[model samples]
Target chain A: MDFKKITIFAGHYGSGKTNLAVNLAFHHKAQGRDCTICDLDIVNPYFRSKDSEEDFKAAGIRFISSPFANSNVDLPSIPAEAYSVFAKSDTYSVIDLGGDDRGSYALGRFSEFLTDESTYDMLMVINQYRPDTRTPEQVLEIKKEIEDACHVKFTGIVNNSNLGRETTVELIERTREFADECAKLLNLPLVMTTYSDKLEKPNMPNPFAINIMAKDIWQV
Target chain B: MAEKVLMKGNEALAEAAMRAGCRFFFGYPITPQTEVAAYMAKHMRKNGGTYLQAESEIAAINMVLGAASAGQRVLTSSSSPGISLKSEGISYLAGSDLPAVIINIQRGGPGLGGIQPSQSDYFQATRGLGHGDFHVIVVAPSTVQEMVNLTYDAFDMADLYRMPVMILGDGILGQMMEPAEFPTESSRKLPAKDWATTGTKGERKKNIVNSLYLDPAELERTNFERYERYEKIKATEQKAECFMTEDADIVVVAYGAAARVAKNAVLAARDAGIKVGIVRPITLWPYPSDTLKEVAKTAKAFLSVELSMGQMVEDIKLSIDCAKPVYLCNRTGGMVMKPDEVLAKIKEISGGLK
Candidate 1:
């Protein structure tokens, strides 16, 4: 309940940032706090946080994303209402950023607001199982690319590593050292290690359990 | 050996192609399938390959033609409209007898349809990928893991047949994430590129790769030769997955994303005491007629489930020579049919059979 005013989730593609963003928004809403989740995903054509717009609406949380989000039109046009995330100080803002540096370019437009350390927490969500970010050095390389593109530094690291559906508690425990190594190498605090709500919670520090929101088409 | 990892279908196909020794990728980005080009751009060079984002889909496919003619395992990918643009180059590749793998991560439409999953390009891919009396080996993958395996195999099939091979996927397959393992070693002994127009080093005569035949007699002769090769492929390369079809009275036929949905429906229908089975064709061009012909011996009726207005239904009818009634269960314009909808169709067909 003590998150920063604006929490931005950025990571590699399919690293579970969209799911974390949705969970964070629900987390804020459940605690009797107003929240707005803005989708800054231009790089990925499918699977964005905006896909849960109806769920967000039913929960009374504000959603801002491309008009083309969840539509037949595949455009990268971010809505003008996304600017309200910074202007409204009363509502907690969660930004679900697209994957990699190209995805982070949309974040560059809001660099002026994100510069203040106290107001925003820019977390680099990393999954060690992903092909591109399998190690601390690889994660760091992405961190630098994202930092360069968005012109904002990642304040902390979030370990959200797991194989989809085949994830086990043992696998989570095995990845603890990898997450710690990433934090150490990046010189950032380990903000949290997320696990799917469907699985039993593993014995890990900063355990943030999240509901899976960005689902495969077959799951429907 | 690379560890099994969770990958989006598009990325998995791109990664598999690289592992299959595909060193050149020429593509222009489009919806759903953009990740394939993006992945190639990010990692292809690291794997000792060339990834070029061409100015247009036409240019990209032509580039594939050029590289493939030089005996390099090359690839190009696009969505529905972009694939249409590349059709001319694809025909040229076939005409020139070059080997290349073309990926169509299908979206809806005749014009600029929708940016969602679709199988409407079934006719375009199987029957008329280009204006040619030739054929491209069209392989449709239902899962991301299959996307990996089929993509790795597509390159080999292209080379083995000395023609183009297609990996026909839909937006759902392109975007979904699944755990996939990459093959470390190829199963086939690839034929040497003696037919490649690599060059003359003064030791041998120069080889030429061309599609133009001015004389009508010469063109007809070449067409006959190509059809003979096509016949060989038809005999050997027809692949399908028959699920619970041994004693079923109603067999459902589908491919790609629609097949995945139809399989789920078939399972549900069987549980509900409706005798139903699914026949999923892995290769659309080869059509897997023999498998359907076999199933038709016992099946009272067949349902051709699709994401189009029944394009594959014609093939299903022809596959079995219309011995039994063939029904179409489909959704078009980016709308995918639900499992329940397909189950209802199976029930209707079963009721009529009774």
Candidate 2:
């Protein structure tokens, strides 16, 4: 799961991309690469990269947490620590963007610094089951909106499709064609299909599995 | 005409309002409901309509009152906390018998509770809003199609009774996208603004749109007249929808997004050979009480589901007004209840009767 020097994850909220990014961060760190993960979400602080600071620290992964002492404030504060990704060219960094266009637009401020820099991948995560992206057309519209907001092109697409805890192997299998339709619309490569299962199983379409960790502990 | 276009509920409802002859809008921006004002800002000016974002919710609602007093169709929208601030002005509109539409795309709240979707404001909406004996006509919509339908008709109904009308939605309904079709402009019907405060020009007689009455007896007489209008509205304007309710012994009652979840649970329960149905309240204030009371006569029990701390359950009991075991299945503080959990409650309640 070790990616390019800079890997940015973008998707709507509850698309399960945050958990997938967390898994990829630890995977890169375990592969003996210097890794950093930063929370680029100024819209919603819940279920973002900042909430997993302790776990990232345990794995020797540097985390750029939200600057606000109160996470709920609508302050547009992008941490200065996040710019280390642009400076340190060798660091395998993953950025968890805000859940929507409003959150994703923060990347536009750093567009000058992110110009074709030393190997980067910005993948738009698509979950077919999410209410906002029920169709391939909708997914394409969201991708265009994010591109318009961030002024950065999406390099690839990731099919992190699942129905929360009710996800099944067959459900994931059903999502493959939907993901393909979206990928074909954007002419982008399908990166990987992620599953919450940690097992190595054959006969499945793809095997990018994650031991899910980040969750809202405050949720009732 | 364009067949159907994908739009968020907030935007769709705003478009519908404009098509319904509402040429004036005043609202403050708030979470999960800002799309309405954003859309209005982009298009209201081009359409020869007036769109103003007030300094606050208080200022917005009063602007609505002012524009409506001039006999112009006007609208305003906000979320839970913002709606609370507008309640004082809404009460004033009710007292003055002015017609206006106020959309509350609800969010979790008691005091700036959270930005997530919730249904806890049923009490404040259906019961008297402020310090007055008045009721705003509350309409609850479960889908984007209904959001368009209800918002298009809210203005007409408000004018029909010369009272305040509310489109009580939640964050999910406001932010979620779906296909909606707008009514043809020619098909729209609006009463003439003859009662307008446009310069009297010494035509015949001046019109006063004030809500104040100095004498105690006069105030009491004005209230009686208002109650007479409310009674007429209640008799003719109750709306509801029933799903799989023909032969079901257990009924699940809910509205808005909570109704969406309950509909899924009822479908799953029906497939498992359990007789269950869902009764969705479309008009929540003049709530579908008569229909619910009739359905209660045949059902074994009633389960009123909500995304709040069990506020609508009180109305459910009042509608039936019986000992027929009207129970509650609820979640609060921005938590959405899952289908399996609600299904389990259905089984548990039905099991007790056996």
Candidate 3:
């Protein structure tokens, strides 16, 4: 349940960052924190953070969706409320950036606001199931792209590896070494590894059990 | 036998091409098909092969043409819209009688459709991808392992026949994970590329690689020659799988991902005491039309299950050209039909048959 006052999520497409962002936003709001979820996803038109906008608002969390999100138009418009997340020191802001270099360019425009990288936590989500981000070197290559575009360093890693609802507990358990290798390569803490299973395993380190409602429906 | 590795269909296809000694690849990135290009880019550089991302799909296939003209094993991969963009090059390749491989990891489309898995390109593949009376050797694969073996064979098939070969897969196959063990051995003996425009060094007549036959008589003759080859190909290179066809009433005709889904429905319907089977076409160009006719003789009806609205069903009906009724069970634009839904359709058809 530990998180920074402001945490930014970014990764390759299908890395499960949106699911994690939504999960964390709900977690903080449930704990009675002033949580705000920013959906800055313009990389993919579908399966984005804004799909949970009504859910986030219903749970007493402020939601900032992309200007033209969920529409046919792909205009790159960053909402003003995205910048205000930085000003509110008492609020727990969750920024769900889009996948890959195409989605991260919008993050660069907010470079001036991210001058203090120490206060804000940037979590690079990795899902090795995706071919492009399958290896630690490939993960580093993608990580570098996001870092260069966002003009901020990633403080930690989140191993949110799964193949939708078909993902099993053993698959999440098996990915720990791969995630550890990637964390070692980046010299960052493996802040959390997510699983959708209801039961928690004993040997899991920094495990975050979550319920993924948005992703499974789309897989169907 | 090579060790088994779980690979996505797109990645495995590219790897299979690499093993088949395909040294040149040109592509433009489009999903659910970009992994093929990405894999080529990552490996081709290290392996001392040529991998170039062209400015567009049109340019990519033209690059394949240039490489094939030089008698090098070449390839290009794309999705539906990107493949549509490469139509000109595809026609040119067919007309020139060049040997190359094109993999279409299909997505939903008539235009710029959604980027989800679909088998909507059945008509484009079987009825010729572009203009002119031509056909590519279209091979539809249903599994990741087949993605490897079929792609490897597609190169040799393209060379043996001096024609382009299309490996038709869908988004689910492209993105799904499954265990695949590429065969270390293949018995396909490829023909020589004597017609290649590689330099003759003044030892023989200079070979020309041209698609344009401006003279009407000569063009007609060329078309006649191509059709002869097509007829021979039709006679020889047809592959299909008939699952539980014996003593079955209803047969489901599908290919690629839809076939796998339909197989489940077929089995489920059988448990419910319906005599249902499935006919999966592995080769789409020289489609398994005869198989449908053979099944049509005994079965009550045939259901054409697809990810598109009644594209391949036309081929099914034409294949039989009979009085037996043919039905369609389809979903378009990236939606996957559930097995239970397919079972319901089968039940409805069974009622009609009764």
lDDT of 2: 0.81
Residue B67 lDDT in model 2? 92
Where is model 2 more than 4 Å wrong at Cα?
Answer: A1-81, A87-105, A117-220, B185-190
List the lowest-lDDT window of 10 residues for candidate 1 chain A.
A211-220
lDDT agreement with native, every candidate = 0.90, 0.81, 0.84
Chain B TM-score of all predictions, in order? Answer: 0.99, 0.97, 0.98
Instruction: Give per-residue CA lDDT, model 2, range A1-220, as digits (tens).
Output: 3378888888765566667778888989878988888777766523456667778878899888667723435466888887787785677888888766777888888777677834788888877765467788988888888888998888888887765555667767877788888889989888888887643342334458777675422112
When only the first chain is scored, the TM-scores of the models are 0.96, 0.90, 0.93
Which candidate gets the maximum lDDT versus the true structure? Answer: 1
Give a tens-digit lDDT track for model 3, residues B1-354.
853555667788988898888999999988788878877987887778999999989999999999999999999999999999999999999999999999998887879887877899888887859999899999999988889889888998899999999999998888765666677766887777888887989999999999998799998999999999999998899889999998889889989988888888888889999999999999998988778888888988889999998998888888889547889999988787888778899999999888
lDDT of 2 at B231: 89
**Per-residue lDDT over B282-310 for candidate 2, one digit per residue giving the tens place of the 0 to 100 score:** 99989888889888878888999998887
List the candidates ranked by TM-score, beginning with the highest: 1, 3, 2
lDDT of 3 at A121: 87
Model 1's chain A TM-score stands at 0.96
What is the C-alpha lDDT profile of model 1 across B1-354, one tens digit per residue?
567788999999999999999999999989989999999999999998899999999999999989998999999999999999999999999999999999999998989998988999999999999996989999999988899999888998999989999999999999999888898977877889998888888878888999999998999999999999999999999999999999999999999988888888998998999888989999998999999999999999999999999899899999989899999999999888888899889998888887
Worst 10 residues of 2 chain B by lDDT: B185-194
